[model samples]
Target: MIERLSIIGVGLIGGSLARALRAVGQVGEVVGCGRSGPNLEKAVELGVIDRFTHDPGEAVVGADVVFLAVPLGAMRGALSAIKDRLDASAVITDGGSVKGSVVADAVAAFGKVPTRLVPGHPIAGTECSGVEASFAELYRNRRVILTPLSETEPDALSLVSRMWEACGAEVTTMSVGHHDEVLAATSHLPHMLAFGLVDALARMRENDEIFRYAAGGFRDFTRIASSSPVMWRDICIANREALSAMLARFGIEMTDLAESIRRADGDHLLEIFERAKAARDRYVDRVK
Candidate 1:
């Protein structure tokens, strides 16, 4: 169990982890650190954290576990701020969506990927933000991927894995590059497409009518477009290499679909749709 857990950025992911740890009695004290006083205070009032602070260094002073849950862009600064204050035995981890860049940021901040630093990403979230959007059950049955570097200590990795497991998450490990590439294709690209589609539709001349006539399909598809723009922007930039490649591949697929429709190639369109449906169904079944 973690005697003291410090979360640098008490937003949805961080708050949910704190709540989950508390719920399972896996943590003794939860300290939240963030730039927004109001949000940190809200996290404290919501009982997601035992205390709050604007200073990252102070927050992690004696923390046995430190979770850096800030945006990817802010990772370097957050890590730097707490690097000097972290206890010798403290285990550092992050909830960044992009792992490759996060690994680089940690190295940049500390001159190396410390054995105690474990890079992680939780494959669970809602179209919500802030502490109020968090709950203890957010990670229940969810997958938390850890990307441990060559320098990562086995004990540190095991501790983080167990922590996530205690929070009801199924832990998995993979190379940082592989994690980033997979996330770029599956998670980042979809969010990017959702945001782009919504933006394009909103700018149409018949935007009002388009929205008024929209149905559940549109709502369900674009639900993730409501995510924090700044956070998504940073993710896109951080994982640009993999994301760009995925985007190019998607563009080719879209072009093919468009041409099939233009040529009235019903067979080609049907084949593509059928394949997509089968893949999605299989994924849904596996998750269930």
Candidate 2:
């Protein structure tokens, strides 16, 4: 049972956590922190947090649990700002998509206290952002990945896991490296491809009709391209190694398909298309 929880960077992820935690009675109070005064004020007005502050120190004081929900690039600064104010027994966690860098930063910033840090990535989000866009049930039935290092304290891990579970998340544990690698293929690479495709087409004056016809397939594929540039940019840089490897693999696969099409190799094309269709059908059935 967390008596008090502090959420740094109270945008979509942070605000949603605060709201969901409160809805499930997982915490006695939720304090929000953000660099923007107006965003903090809006969060309070929206009741996403019980209290709001620009000072990370003020937000974290006496908190039994703290969640760093900012962009991956802002994480180090946010943790440093609140490190001194964190309760010695407080369990610090993050909602960062990449965990390896965040965990390393935590170790460097807090030294021995890093054992209390639990890095998490909730595979739940919309193309939306800000406190106004937050939904209390955003985490419901969603997967929350906890990348706990070998040195991470079991008690601290348990506390963080319980909090996410209370928010209606299905929690799973993975190594930081493995989490980054898998997410590179599933989430990061796709976002990169979407943005790249959109940007390439945007350079053409005749492509205005593309946006006009962006309903159905185009809409679904480019949904993630509409995500916050700041957030995605940070994620890309932070998980550069894993993302680069995945991108290289993706390029090889794309080349194979392109060659097949160029050669009019019907059998090869059919094999690739059939496998992709079957995989997608399996995933859809399981999800349903």
Which is the leading candidate under lDDT? 1
Q: Assess every candidate by TM-score.
A: 0.99, 0.97
Per-residue alpha-carbon lDDT of model 2 for 27-88, expressed as tens digits?
A: 78888888898888898888888888888888999999999998999888888888888788
Report backbone clashes per prediction: 0, 0
**Poorly placed runs, candidate 1 (over 4 Å):** none
- Tens digit of per-residue lDDT, candidate 1, span 1-288: 999999998999999999999999999999999999999888989999999889999999999999999999999999989989999999999999999888889889999888899999999999898999999999999999999988999999999999999999999999999998999989999999999999999999999999999999999999999999999999999999999999999999999999999999999999999999999999999988
Candidate 1 clashes between residue pairs 3 or more apart in a chain or in different chains: none
Per-residue lDDT, model 1, residue 212, is: 98
lDDT of each: 0.94, 0.90
RMSD of 2: 1.2
Whose TM-score is greatest here?
A: 1
